[model samples]
Target: MFSKVLVANRGEIACRVIRTLHRMGITAVAIYSEADAGAKHVALADEALCVGPAAANKSYLNIEAVIEAASSTGAEAIHPGYGFLSENVEFARACTAAGITFIGPAEAALEIMGDKIRSKNHVAQAGVPLVEGISEPGLSDEQLISAGEKMTFPVLIKPSAGGGGKGMHVVERPEDLGETLATARRVAKASFGDDTLFIEQLIRSPRHIEVQVLADAQGNVIHLGERECSLQRRHQKVIEEAPSALLDEATRARIGQAACDTARSVDYLGAGTVEFLVSDEEPEKFYFMEMNTRLQVEHPVTEEVTGIDLVEQQIRIAAGQPLSLRQEDITLTGHSVEARIYAEDAEARFMPSAGTIIGLQEPTGEGIRVDSGMLPGLVIGTDYDPMLAKVIATGADRDQALSRLHQALGGTIIHGLTTNTAYLQQLVADEDVRRGQMDTTMIERKLPDLQFPTPQQHHAVAAGLLAAQLKGLHPETAGNQEEGPTGWQPDGWRHSGAQNPVFAVSWQPPGTTAEPQEFDVIVDGSSRLIPVGEGRYLLRSSATATEVHLTAGEGSRQTGTEIWISSGDFTGALSVLDQEAATHRQLAEIEAELTEALPEVTAPMPGTVVAVGVESGHEVNAGDVLVVIEAMKMEHRLAAPTAGTARINVALGDQVSLGQVLAAVEAEQAENTESKD
Candidate 1:
């Protein structure tokens, strides 16, 4: 075991590695950028170092800076927790040359498996079954189209140099192939700095099953069963489970052996994952996808089922330790499921939502485990991945595991920022998901039907009443108070006895387009509304009396009052809008509407403009790509809204703000001229 190890990553994965290192009695060192200086991982490390600025290229991806930090801190090994430099072969080689262990596979294995095209070729040569498609790299757009024509329609364009579903596109129609390929290439270049791509046959109703393999330098390799990562959105895995319900005992053994053989062929060391695309129609047939050369994001599920700590194994293997157990020694136990909780709006097409996490309540129980790196005051910016945490649940069987996962999601609370918690709950409860009948396209197919829980009338009333009560207690407050009528007393009462002290407020739930529900809270001093201990409240209505757990705190005037209300399984935040604040917000919305009525392409999020496809006076059709903005390590293309001539405003490499105009489009008009003689 290493005496000291440095984690060359950030966020939850870094924190996870640090915890394992502490368990091994090793000093844990953390490297951070300016944005993550106050992150939870930094606070948990034994020693911390600031590598560079907030941009990942300057910090986490800076191989020299990371090596220097490890050297300065006396770290004997460096753990590149998945993503960033984890798959960078040069970084791994640098660590080895620097006399420090990389805590992962050998650089040779990384180089072979990092490129999807090359990895497929190697795996095929090793007698592993591969997906039927073109594995050749550097095919031009026309060549790619030609290859796809031979493979038939509905082909997938995938970046050969990177993983994590960053630069992948599915083209169902023949005519859309050209545009999709161009966009995929651009995203691949921006993300991996290599636009090398390959065309693959899009399997219909396929289950994504990956086998976790662990190896040591002594040439001993074993498999840790399999995980089902079929539930996905935008080609990104959303939910994952271990001991796939789809595979029978015979099939499981065959696939597990194949994964082990794949690893052995490369003399793979440390932890790696071999992915496969299993056809739902033909469960016996599985095709090799690619191998993740490092630890995976959904590795917790495999850990729960196999009773193995993969990180500990990686460190021991990197230290030249032999395998403690053989393939026969490993046994699969209970079923487990993991849900990735991200700071994104599922309803808004999973757009990343970044802001301070005002409040958090993680689920706790015997079968539940939460690996998180977020605190109450953590500021989630657009500079990194939006994943907040991962919640994993285990049970005796698949049904029990599914039930526990649903319960855990309901109990998890993330206040202030929009999250996919509600969407996750809906997904796990779906009939197909409950029956273990899901595929890679399930989430995208069912996204339109996933509904957020609607706020009940009583909940809205409770929030309004709570807001009004707090305002009365803290009268003369300027920042969050709503402007009341003239001469109204600070005690929440009017001088005129004839008028009832009726307060009108509106409550808006998170990530919904529905109009805010209005409530009239009549407080004549006769009604009793008292706050109990620990965010609980007792309210007396004209019809009945009820006790509600509610917490109210001041927020910016623009955000209204942040109120957390718990009503059974539905616990969430509500923005209570008083009359004055509501009117001001309405006016702001009107202004935004007026501005949007113009034909202009605006930045949806704050990011750098990577490319501008159209120039001034360039004619464009609807859905033509105009500008590409990169935010949170993802590229978003701004498309033309309608047929028009363009007027470009922003240039390449320009940093843009949210809603900043990047270009304007004028409606194309018919050219008129005098009749020629």
Candidate 2:
């Protein structure tokens, strides 16, 4: 075991590694960028070092800085926790040169698997069933088109380097090949600094299943069971589970052996994941996608189901130890599911939402584990991925696990920014996902229904509201209002007497729209009307300056003076006002637009247009991506009206303002556009 180890990463994964290191009695060292100086990972580590600027190239990705940090700290090993330099071959080689162990596959294997085209070829030669496609060298568009004729339609064009759905594209037909290839090439060059590409048959209705494997330098390798990662958006996994519902015992064994074989073939060391694309057809067929040469982001679910800590195994293997548990020793336990809570808006095309986390209330109980990156008052800037945490739950079976997950999500509260918590909760209870009838395309296919309101939603909302109100009244509720809001001020109402109040407030239950909901509450023995909007209410009582939190006709529960607030049950907060003179100047310009007339079209947010799908005088249907804007490292498609003739005022490279008229339609059709908004 390493006496001192350097975690060459930041955020949640870094914090996760530090916890494990602490448990194992190892001193954990952390490296941080300028922007991450106050990050949670830095505070959690035993020792921290400031490496470079906020930019990744200057900090997290800087090999020299990382090596220097380890050397200065006298660390024995460096754990590259996913992303950043985790899969970088040169970084691993540098660590080796520094006489420091890299807790992953060797530099040589990293080199081989780092390149997708080469890795796919090596695995194919190892007799691993690979996705059918073209791997010919230096294939041009003409040659690719010719090759496509032999295979099938809906081919995937992918970069030969790196993964994570970056530099990947799918063309539905031959006519879309040119644009798809060009786009893939551009993204590939940008993401991997390599423009090399390959073609593969796009398997429809595919389920992403990955096998976790551990190997030692002594030529011994063992396979952990599989994890189902079918719930994804833009190739990024949103939810994952262990012991896939689709894989039968025999198929699971076969895939496990194949995964182990591939690991041994590469002389793989430490922890790695072998990913596969399993078809949803009868007698599902599995094909290899690629091998992730480092620990995976969704590895916790696998650990929960198998009762194995993969990080511990990785450490043991890195220390030149053999496998502690053979294949038989590993027993698959009850079902486990993990939901990745991200700072994003599901209703808004899943765009990343950046703001200060005013409040955070993580779920706690048996069979639940939360690996988080952010805490209260943490600003979720646009500088990195928007993932906030991974919440995992285990149960006796799938239904039990799913039910626990629902409770966990409901209990998990994140305020101050929009998150996918509600979206994930809806997904877990989804009929298709519940029945285990899931595929890669299932999310996209059922997205509309999942996002929209259901018949039972109102009941759930009412119950949640009542529960929140009742919880607020508890003297020691799960959520603490004493935890001050991040940047907002909470009125000192408790100190103030219940007299000369400006607002009268009370709780209300489910009632008719015209009539008030039933709430038997009295402050100073006076009846008050509790305003209920939709299923919840925000109450301000005249007896006190601070807003009283009441649910289901409960007593007043105080809240902290902060812009951000999150309690497991009662999740609410106030927004901080920047009252400085400089702040007023910043809001001056925006105030003019607010008072002026509305424009013909508007730019949703600051972004670069990846495509101008509509041209001047072009007819477009509703929900058509008039322009695709890339913001916060994610794409946001600006759609058209139900019916409109687009008269584009902005060109492809032009930058448009928020609420600026990017296009206009005829007067009669313009009303339709306005109505949609």
Candidate 3:
């Protein structure tokens, strides 16, 4: 066994590998960027190294830096935990040249499986079933159109070199195929550095099932059942489960054997997952999609059910140890379900959310597990993937596992930043999910029907009360501040004759830009924060008692003292605004009625401007692309609001804050009038 291993990744997966290393008595070395100096993984490791700056390319994906860090730390092997450099074939070769073991598949496997088009061709030769399409490389656009004319109308256009739903598009009409191919080529070229194109038949209502396979250097291989990853949004998995409800024993054995064959075909070593697109109607028919040559983000569910440590297996394989367990020894004991928690707003098309985690609550009980790198004051910036953690649950059956997962999600709390916790809870209980009638399109299809909780008067009251307590009153205000400003105590003050303080506060629900509703909370002199440990508080009143979770944060706003609160399924921010701030916002009702056309183009979220389509004072149509901002590894193109002159305010490479005006459209009417004059 290797005495020391370096984790060339950050966040939750890095922490996960370090934990396994410590359990095995192996020293764990962690590498981090400047932004992650205080990260949880760094604190968990025996040694740490600073790779580079916050930018992923200069840091986590820096091959030379990672190799140097491993050498300096005296690590025998390096683990690339998903994302970043996990699937980089060049990084693996670098480690080998540096005499540091790469704890993943061999170079041959990486070369063959790294490219989707190549993997499909390789696996098909191994007798693995494949979806029908034009998967050959080096085909021109005109040739592809000519070839696609005879195939089905709706087809999938994807890059040959990447996964994770990036650079993949579905074309429904034959006429739209050429246009989509151009867009796909651009995206694929930008994301994967290879514009290699391929076509695949778009399987309708397919269930995504993948088999986890492990092999040693001696060519010994075994399968550990299949995981259902059909719950997805935009091709990224949101939830996963082990021992899929769709597969019977016969089909399970078949798919498992097919996965083993894929591993053998590559002369594979270490842990890998072979993904397949299974027909929802015909459970017996499954087609190979692609192979992931590293640990998957959804690997926890397989670990929970199989009672095996995948990381341990990876290390052992890399150390040239033979397979310790056979296929007969592997058994799926129980059902496990996992929900991915991301720093994103589910209500607003799941846009990435960023900020400091002021408070957190991870559920723990029978059959519940949490794999996370979340710590108080952890700054979730827009530099990398948005997934923060995962919540997994196991049970004797699928129903119980689903039920436990739902309960666990309900108890999960993250304040000071928006998350998909509430949405995950709702998804677990969704009818399609519960009945096992799910497809990859289920989440997007059912998103409109999922009812998220909105803030009410009680929520407002709880937040207001907490805000008042969090910001205590001054001694003078405690006595009588009849003439003083109300916000000296944050919109709360003791009346000259009254015994208690009154908090005139406003509550804003999560994921909204609307004005907060006004609420006056009268806190009795006796009303105080009870000693409730772990973020929960019960506010006692004459009428009723309500419990809310809260955290005092340096608010995003300039003037308000923001108190983040959570009660039941709803989370919101309570702002204590002085009279001037509140009245000014509410008084601007007429301005809200102005035309959205020729509107100010503001940054929807904080990000860096990657592209500027037009220079200042250029004429553009309503749909012309104005600027492109990249955040959380996704590019958002801002377009003109209406036909007008583009007045650009920001240049390329400029860092922008949310709501910062990037440009504005000067209406054509103004241009016409100026021309006439």
Candidate 4:
């Protein structure tokens, strides 16, 4: 085994690799950008090095800087963990030249399979089943149109140089082909620096299946069953599982052998995944999609079911070891499912959310595992992927695994930032998902019907009572005799009345536009507000009594006292208004003025404006695209809410903050009157 290995990545995958290296008795070295100075991966590594700035292009993708870091830290091998430079052939060759082993396939294999067009051709020649499409390179717009016509309607135009759903478009009509192709080419050039694209037949309702293959230097290759990755959004996988519920024993063997054949055709080495698009209607028929020439993000599901440490195998193979186990020796033990927990809002088209994690509680028990790089104080930024962690559950059967996954997600708490935790819970319990009847389009189809649990009245009342008690304990206003256990006044009664002090409070549920619920809570005595711990309280009322987990954060100047409350499965933020503070009245006046202002298009999140589709005096209709903002490597198009004349404020390439007005739209009465005259 190698003495030291450098992880050439960041976030959860880097931490995962470091953990396995430590188990193998190898010191792990970590590389980080400026944004990840205090990241979990950096702290977990035996040695750390700063590569470059926060941008991936300047840091993680800088091949020379990574190589220098590895060499300077005396790392014997470099493990490119699934992103950035992981699939770059040049990085592999550079590591080889510098006498450091690359823990992946050979550079030759990467070159052959890295290009979609080239890989399709190679696999087709080797008799692997392929989807009908045009793989010829350097096709012009006219040529692409002609090819699309030949393939019939509903064809997919994809950039041949990159993956992750970037620069990919689907056109269902011939009339829209030209514009779609132009957009695809432009995005492809910008994203991958290659305008080369190919047309493929769009398989309706296909199931994504991939076989994990490991090859040693001695030419021994074996497959580790398969994983179902059909649950996706915008071509990126959301949930994945091992020992696919769809595949039978016979079909599993066939697909496994086909994947191995594809790998052997190029003398592949280390860890690689062979992806395929299996028709949902015809499970026996499968078409090769592409081969990822490095470790996969969903490899843990396979690891859990097969009881094999894939990272350990990769290192062993990189050290010129032969295959430790043959194909017959490998076995799939149970069902395992993994849910990718991202810092994103599922209700808002999965828009990426960035903020500091105020409090975190991970689930732990039998059949549950969490692989994460996040800590309580970590800041999720927009410079990298929004995935915070992955929660995986294993069981003897699929039903049990699904149940455990649902429970695990409920027990997991990620506070202060918006996340997909509630959405994940709904997905697991979805009727079709629970029955193992799902396809690539199921999530998008069912997204509109999925509902998040609403916060109960008792929960809100608890928050209100807690907030009122906390407010009275303020040393600045209350008698400074040192607050009581419940953070109430020393006398435990307001001087205003002996009956008790009743205050109106409001609570806004997470991820909703509904009006904030209002209720009145009376703090009569210590029995109603009991302090359990430093940041926990029990609120008792006539209707109900509940335990509330409260965490006090820095007070927002606009919202006053901000407290995060978690009761049962519902979590929300409560802003307390004493109705007595002078500041509250001032805030009310400011809010009233803002609410009466002219209608304007504002940025929903912090991002950079990539495109502005309107200008001053330009007339736009409702639902027309007004501006495109890029955040966390994804593009979101903001549309005009109503028909009007647009007065643009933000230009292309300008940074915008949440709720910052980008444009104002007024009724186009002037234009209409002029036209009539």
* Residue-wise C-alpha lDDT for candidate 1, range 1-677, written one tens digit per residue: 78999999999999999999999999999999999989999999999999999988899999999999999989999999998999999998899889998988887889889999999999888788887788787789999887788877688889998788777889899889988888888888877778999988888789999999999998899999999999988788999999999999999999999999999888899999999999998888899999999999999999998899999999999999998989898898999999999988776677777777766778899799999998878989888888989999999998999899999998787766778888898988899998989999988888777776756767766776777667663212322333476436443434443233344555555444468766665544444556675556676666777676676656655567878776555666677766566667778888988774548888766788988998878999989989998887678788998888888899999999877999888887778887989
Full-model lDDT, candidate 2: 0.72
TM-score, per-candidate, Cα-based: 0.90, 0.76, 0.92, 0.91
Candidate 3 lDDT, 1-677, residue by residue in tens: 89999999999999999999999999999999999999999999999999999988899888999999999889999999987788889999999999999999888899999989889888887778888999888998888888999888689898888777666888999999887787678667656678899998788799999999999988798999999999998788999999899999999999999999998999989999999999999999999999999999999999999999999999988999898899999989889999999999888777889989999989999999999999998999998888999999999999999999998988888987899998998889888899999999888788888787776666655665565555564323343444445433344344334344554577654445676577765554334444377778875555667777878777533346677778888876677644444555555544665636448888877898978989999999998989988888677788998888999999988999988999998987643444543
lDDT of 1: 0.84
lDDT comparing candidate 4 with the true structure: 0.83
Q: Which is better, 2 or 4, measured by lDDT?
A: 4
Better of 2 and 4 by TM-score: 4
Q: TM-score winner among the candidates?
A: 3
Which structure among the candidates has the greatest lDDT?
Answer: 3
Error of 4 at 266 (Å): 1.0
| lDDT string, candidate 4, 1-677, tens digits | 79999999999999999999999999999999999999999999999999999878899999999999999989999999986888888899999899999999998899889899999999999888899899899889999888777677788888897776666787889889998887777667655667899989888799999999999888888999999999987777889999898899999999999999999999999999999999888998899999999899899999999999999999999999999899999999989999999999876677788878887778898899999989878988877778899999999999999899999998777777778988998889888998889998788888888776656656555655666556554212333333434434432445442334444556665444568776664544433556786556676655666677776555544464666776676766666555454256577778898785556788777888878887878999988878888777677788887889888888988989877898877865544444543
lDDT of each: 0.84, 0.72, 0.84, 0.83
Ranking by lDDT: 3, 1, 4, 2
What TM-score does structure 4 among the candidates reach?
Answer: 0.91
Per TM-score, what order, best first?
Answer: 3, 4, 1, 2
Candidate 4 Cα misplacement greater than 4 A, ranges = 186-195, 472-504, 507-514, 525-547, 581-591, 594-596, 670-677
Candidate 2 lands at a TM-score of 0.76
Q: Deviation in angstroms for 367 in model 4?
A: 0.7
